[model samples]
Each structure stands twice: as C-alpha cells, then as structure tokens.
Target: MLGSSDPQNARPASLDAIDLSMLAELERNGRLTNAALAARVGIAESTCTQRLRSLRDRGVIRGFRADIDPAALGLTLQALITVRLGTHGREQIRGFEQRVRSLPSVLTAFHVAGADDYLLHVAVESAAALRELVLEHLTTHPHVRHVETQLVFEVLEGSGMVPREPVHPPHV
Candidate 1:
C-alpha cells in the first residue's frame, strides 16, 4: 500500500549499532526472504521478524517501491521548477501542495528554504507539456508568485543512491 502502517513494523534500536551486516545484506538485495534475512543477521527467524516489525512500527522502515524509467513511459522531458510564493503562510503552503499534487506531470514537490520556496520535479512528454506545467498550471495557481524551471540532462541510478527499505523523513 502507498500509505499504510502496522504496529509490528517498528525499528529495534538505532542506538545499538544497526546490524551493519543486516543493512549490507538488505542493500545488496531488498527482497531477501525473512528466513534469509534472519540467517544473515545471525538471529532466529522469529527474532528477525520481531525486530523488523519493530523497526517498521517505529517509522524506521517505510515502504518498498519500484524505480521506473520515465522515458519508457513516453515522458522524455524532465524539469526542476523553482517556485516562489506570494506569501509565507501555513494556508499558502497547504494550497501550494494541494495544487501541485493534483498535476499529473509532477513527480515530486519539495518546500525548500532559500531563493525559492518550493522545488518541483516534473516529467512530461514534450516542451509544450513543460510549458503548460510551468507557465499555465503552476504559475497561475493562486499562491504561486514566481516560477523558474531547468531541464534535466541526466539521471543516475545505482548503489548507495537508492534505499532498500522505505523510510519517510519528517515533512516540514
């Protein structure tokens, strides 16, 4: 599920050195069976299950997702849009998130601190789509003050770059 939580999914303990071995094993292959994970962690399968559950419940383990290629989906254009807000208020942020989330081309939306108040990762089929997304949809939103976008030239996928398990960092 995209946003489901179970009490059993909680972290064991972060203070105690995370089983580096377990992490390394998971890093190598996220889909390792529970039995295999237990064996790699040198613990009983039940113990492994309990620890994994605890890790999940404590918000350590988030969820699993597949990384797909956008180009394969006919979305060849990728752009990063920097958005400036007309006003800094809780309501404005919520409005921005609501509008941004409704757009199909937005892959990710981030509220950042600095020159821009928000950053959006968008993928589209063509320059026209990009223009519609930035000029028509994003800029015209009620809370949006100014917007700037840059095309992406490359994307990287590899080890140490992607997380094996799911984790949601606290949203500001």
Candidate 2:
C-alpha cells in the first residue's frame, strides 16, 4: 500500500476545487467527522461522505495515521542514513528493502535517484543504539556497500495543505 498511487492504482484525471479543499482540511485534521468536514467545505454531510469515499477508492487518500512522538516512546535520537548498495539488481534492491522494513528503529525508507541508492530515517534511544544499528545491521549486510549517518538536531514538521497546483510548469 506504500506506493498505492502508482500506475496500478491511478487516480482520476484531476481533482476539483472541492476535492482539494477536502484534502486541505483533512491534512490539518484527519479525525474530522463527516458533518464537520461538510460544514467547513460548505457541502452536505452525505456529499462529504461520498467525496471522502471516492478519494479513498481512487487512492488519493491512502489511509489515516496518528502522529506518534518518538520522545514519548524513549526514542530521542534521530538520524538520516544514506545507503549505497553494491548491486543494482532488482532482487538485491527488493531484498534490501524487505530487510530494512523489518527494523523497528527505521521510521521510513525512501528509494531515491541520487548519489545514494536509499535514504533511511531512523529513531533510536541513543548514539550507542545508532552505532549498533549501523554496524550490526547496515554495514554488515551483503548488499550495502557504503553508509552515512547524519544526526538530526531537530525535526521541524508541518501539516499544511498540499499544493493544488504543481510548483513547476510542464515542459512546452
């Protein structure tokens, strides 16, 4: 479900103003009831419910999740790890992703097109735990060739509305 918006689950041609407004409101507060969302968007409750269902069915809205605090879970240390793989074969990449996904400390992993093959966001208890994670898990892995860990001093997160229009214009 991670890449639900891929070609297999393509969305409608374009999202209308109402759809964009619903997304903006949901981005602010995912727990809003149908009545509340309808009131805010100036739509009937039934219409709001129908639109929400349509969004979900179209894969525009994947799923709702709670914002969990790493600090509350005693995971105070945060790090971004840049990983370069030794091999670019599909099997190797799939195996590496599967292995990393099982690690509890790893919050998110992005397969990127850059100098590094993948970027991992991890949260641990301390520097020692981070060292263990990198040494025992990442570097020791067969496919991983190089790993770089950068400590995160602070994480500034936002829940603003997603842009209705693309920042960059399409090529002529």
Best model number under lDDT: 2
Model 1 — which ten-residue stretch has the worst lDDT? 1-10
For 1-172, candidate 2 gives per-residue lDDT tens digits of: 4326576565354678898889988988899989999999899999999999888876688899999999899999999999999999999999999989989999999988888999999999999999999999899889999999999999997656476444787789
**Estimated TM-score per prediction?**
0.77, 0.88
Candidate lDDT values, in order: 0.78, 0.89
lDDT per residue for candidate 1 within 1-172, as digits (tens), equals: 2224443453344523335456557667779899999987789998788877765665555655666789999999999999999888898889888989999999988878798998999999999999988878988888888999899999765667334455779899
Query: What residue runs in model 1 are displaced by over 4 Å at the alpha carbon?
Result: 1-15, 18-20, 158-172
Q: Could you tell me how far off, in angstroms, the CA of residue 64 lies in candidate 1 after the best superposition? A: 1.0
Residue 68 local lDDT, model 2: 96
For candidate 2, the C-alpha RMSD (Å) to the true structure equals 4.1
